[model samples]
Target: MTAKLTDAPVRVMIVDDHEVVRRGIVTVIDASPSLSVVGEASTVDEALRRLPAVRPEVLIVDLQLPDGTGIDVMRRARELEPLQKMLVLTSFDDDSALRESRAVGASGMLLKSSRSRDIVVAIERVAEGLTVWPARAPEEDDELSATDQRIVELIGDGCTNKEIADELGIAEKTVKNRITAILHALGLQRRTQVAAREAARRRAGWK
Candidate 1:
């Protein structure tokens, strides 16, 4: 997902379970000239309802929520807009949590302990289709081709074959065939399983 191609401030939505957490982020965003807070949500349910309405250029989300995890929100949000830019701003730095965020199409992950300036920069970066996550390359790929790697990213972003076709400017049949081959190459039975590891050998980093 990419940010709006304009000079206007980035429209951002903050989703956190705690008001104080949200407020702290809000304060940081408010201080950045290139960012603006458009909406806020305290739970997955509320986030689902408000996210589409706000249609933010950047989404700052927490991993744990009252009703569901931020991965649930990002997954649902990606369904509505596969190009939606998202960043997981969480307190946890474990691999399972980080990989989960990557599995749902997050462009970046930032620890809550990071500096205020880092938060502002992460929002801007994700909005532009650039990653802000700590880099930890996967040990190795299962000999996935370049094209196969791209398909994995789209699948993780909740894109259908048709959608992937449109994004890659290929036929729907081609997309389907490639996905099958990709699954075989990765030794994975389901698309969801392979989505956790992605293109460019970009493994989830714990930092």
Candidate 2:
């Protein structure tokens, strides 16, 4: 495939299954001076077929497609161009989807409800090699149960599973389960990372 001309506007591809949504995104990109919609596809197969000919600088893909999920498209697209950027457009807020998208090399997630300006900004950010997750308000940070927060706090304090269980007056196994869920929710691998993140949040006075 021919590489993008250095002087050309940032080329973007839209892969949402909905025609209206695809048009809406195209309009948004068109209005941005630095970005342009170079191609559009409604299914994973279509996206894969067209991607070789139209290798966009960034791909805005919806998670659910008629042929397969956007994750499938992302994996294939990455194989075609390892450096290609991916931005996920989805209505679902499920953590599993977020984790899977990130795992398959998506750089950002934009809700369908996001304003046009935010969508445009996301496209730019992804093109710039930045990872984009939604911003959460202090109140929104309260998604974790109070118990979960306390558990994370104890982790920050370097508590063991037995220590946390005893402190929270719960079974040790319960503490382990809660910690597992917290890691999944935070998309972290280790307890130390979770603890460090929670500590940073506390220091920053975020909720």
Candidate 3:
């Protein structure tokens, strides 16, 4: 479902190199009473040049642009409007893209294959100052090593380090080290958050 409409619609800009994708996003945003597309750009240079004038409250940017990476645009956008909400809409789902997008101050990230309703909802959440991301990639778990992935699965199973080590036939110290590495890789501060995230992913039908 799309977000509830407020008194003033959130102004948004669409920046994608593909015309079809940009138009599709525009259609989605325009259908929502709470969101409005104020501008569109097919390249980083164009987005940067028009950003000041358009001054959208939220920016839906594709990570790949004709002239430069979306990170470049994000850096420039921050310089122009430090508080402006930016949501990354992209086809790339690599960890580097995900991590870099957040590191450069994106409020959210959504894959291109996400449902239109999900996209709209994510934009609304981002416009309202919430961070948005998928529970997990629907495909392979490429970011984590197989051992680390098993550890995440074990954490989800409510296993303690010693129990997990025993189950996996590894030392408890190695288990602790792998757990710490998993937390760092996912940018999470606690084991509980990692467990929660994995649970969410499982609920979302991730194998």
RMSD (CA, angstroms), candidate 1: 11.4
lDDT of 3 by residue, 1-207 (tens): 133366788899989999988898899889999889999999998999999999898888899887898899888998988887898988867778878988989977878887889788778767765666544543435656799899999999999999999999999998887776566456576999988988999998777
Q: Per-residue error at 145 for model 1, in Å?
A: 12
Off by over 4 Å in 2: 1-7, 136-207
Query: 6-112 in candidate 2: lDDT tens per residue?
Result: 76788999999899988988998899898988999999999999999998999989999998899999999999988889999999677788779879988778889
State the lDDT of candidate 1 residue by residue for 119-187, as single tens digits: 886787677555666534344242456777778878878788899999999999988767755654454
The whole-model lDDT of each prediction reads 0.79, 0.83, 0.82
Ranking by lDDT: 2, 3, 1
Candidate with best TM-score: 1
Quote each prediction's TM-score. 0.66, 0.65, 0.64
Candidate 2 global TM-score: 0.65
Q: Which of 1 and 3 is the better model by TM-score?
A: 1
- Point out the worst 10-residue segment of candidate 3 by lDDT: 133-142
User: Global CA lDDT of candidate 1, please?
Assistant: 0.79
Q: Any residue pairs clashing in model 3, and if so which? A: none
